[model samples]
Every structure is written in C-alpha cells, then in structure tokens.
Target: MYGARLQRSTCTNCNAAYTRRYLKVQRRVTPAVALHSRARQRAARRGLPFDLDVSDVIVPSICPALGVPLVVGEMRSPYSPSLDCIRPALGYVRGNTRVISDQANHLKGVLDIEGLIKRAVASVDQRREDYARLAAYLDRELLLADVRRKAALAGAAGEEWAEVAKFLDAAFVRADWKR
Candidate 1:
C-alpha cells in the first residue's frame, strides 16, 4: 500500500498542522512594514509577484472546538491592541476569519460624548443665568442680608467678559443637540 500524499505539514509529536496563510491585523503599520507594503504595492503595479514581502504573527494554533490545529498566519505589526481585519487573506486558513466589531467601544465613545454635552449645556445655562444675574447684582446698592461680599469680579465682567458672554450665548443657542 502507498502512503497518502503530503497534503499539509503537521508536527508529528503534537499533530499540529499549519497551512500557508495569514490574517491581516487592522493595526497601525510600522515604518519597516509600511516600507515593505509600499514595495509590494509598487511591484504589483509593475505586474510582478504580489507576494513581495510576507510578515508573520503567532496566533491561535488550534481550534477551540476541535483542538485541531487551525491553519492561520500571524500578522506582523507595531501597534498594540490592534484588531483583526475582516478581509480574506492567506498565511494559513482553516476557516473564514470572524471579526466582531466591538460595539462596546462605540458605546463608550457615545457615553463620553453624552456626558460632555450634558456638562457643557449645564455650564452654558449657568453662564447665561450668571450673565443676567450680574446686571441685577450690580444694581443692588446696600447689599442684601444673608449674603457675604457679593462681588462681580470672579467671572462675567469687564469689556472682554461681556464680549465673551455675548459670543458664547449665541453659540450655545445654536449648538447642535442632535446626536
């Protein structure tokens, strides 16, 4: 009887098989790798082998469900915490690449933006109230009771202050509230 043809390479000891393919990680390309990529792109334009340069990254070696070596290629990059690209590539591929865009990240940015807007609106309203109050506060002559050293020097005063409040009030009124 004849042995089966060498379909792929596998570690005899652990039976870890690896195919030739790689998954491109969505990362900030480094200067060196960027240079390589540029060269490859140029070569392709000149009708040459597209695989001018190949990088590597050591990713999951085995399937989580079967424990069999999952054919995968590692991506070389300098950026940390970069995500995997969703496109089909080669290094080693046993199955289609699954990339889940972390909705949590978008939600976090949205939450942060919401908080900032709320704080800004509250501050703007306070500023408007304070602006109107200053005119009234200045009119009080004998200084009312139950108050200490009521002065208008802290904020909202002077020619520059008035100009700023005028501009900010108009801006606050027209500020986009629709997210």
Candidate 2:
C-alpha cells in the first residue's frame, strides 16, 4: 500500500468508501508545497524563470530580514512566511530565493539596493538634524544656567566674588568668547 499506487477498482461500494474516508481525514497542505505552487504560478504569470522544487523550499522559524517569528499558514498576516526573490529580475532561482516575513517582503517590494540605501540615508540624516536641534537647545539651557549662577553669586562676599570671576572667565574661555 505504501509503495504501490492505489488503482480504482470496478466496485462502486469500494470507491464510495474510499472517497468517504479520504474526505473525513482531510490532510493538511505542507508549507513547502504551498510556497512552491505560489512561486511557480507567479513566475508563470510574470513570465519569469522558475526552477524551484518543493524540496528546495524551506521555511525558517524566524524571518531573516525582520528577525520576527514567521507564522506559517497564517495568510495575510505581517509575520506570515513568504518566498522572496533576492533579485527579482533573476526570478525564482534556487540561489536567489529566501524565506522572509510577509511584511519584510512588502517593505522591499520593487525597490532595488540603491533605493533602499537612499531611504536609509535619508532616515539617518533626519535623525542627525533632530539631534543637532536638541544639542543647540541644551547648549542654550547651559548658558542660561551659568548666567543664573553668576547672578546668585553677585551678592556674595569679596572672596566668593573672586571665585565668580574665575568661573565666568572659564565659561568665556569654553565659549571661545574674546576678552
């Protein structure tokens, strides 16, 4: 039964019983089978080359791109496992294919390496600008604090006045102020 294929007999009762048993024990589709079928269909529709086999398709526990746990058989979810082509122009070739989360695949859609780099650089530049602004605000607050300290020490005794002068001198030197 394991090695030989099941042949349909001329007995209608046997056929009916087999069909009933098959329907009752509905088998689950494996991830590799589903991914291979989808890749083949997509490659055909897009006129792309496809050489993937069911054995070649392997779903990892976590997405390599997003580092998130891949949820198998959860269609339409962000964390669902998806077969992605590293180079879309190369089609579904064995070396170029990888399993990533659906969200990571969607985020990478149609973008080449140069485009992705440009996006990353833009985000970094924006963050740098924000930090610069924050640093300027902090500098101003520090200067204001120095002024308040100087004002508080103005009513102190002569020796304390000398210390205030030295503090002001150091502050001016730090600020690169002339005289």
TM-score of 2: 0.53
Against the hidden reference, what TM-scores do the models get?
0.15, 0.53
* RMSD of each candidate relative to the true structure: 23.7, 23.8
Tens digit of per-residue lDDT, candidate 1, span 1-179: 12233643454423222212111331233323533454356545655434333342222322211122333223432211211221113211211111111221121222233343444355565443333332222222112111212222355344455455445434322333221
Candidate 2 per-residue lDDT over residues 66-172, each given as its tens digit: 55677765445888778877668889976566676787677667555555554555656544343333233234434544554455554566457557545753442
Q: Which portions of model 1 show Cα errors greater than 4 Å?
A: 1-157
lDDT of 1 at 122: 57
Against the true structure, candidate 1 reaches a TM-score of: 0.15
Question: Which parts of model 2 have CA positions greater than 4 angstroms off?
Answer: 1-29, 123-179
Looking at candidate 1, the ten consecutive residues that score lowest on lDDT are 91-100
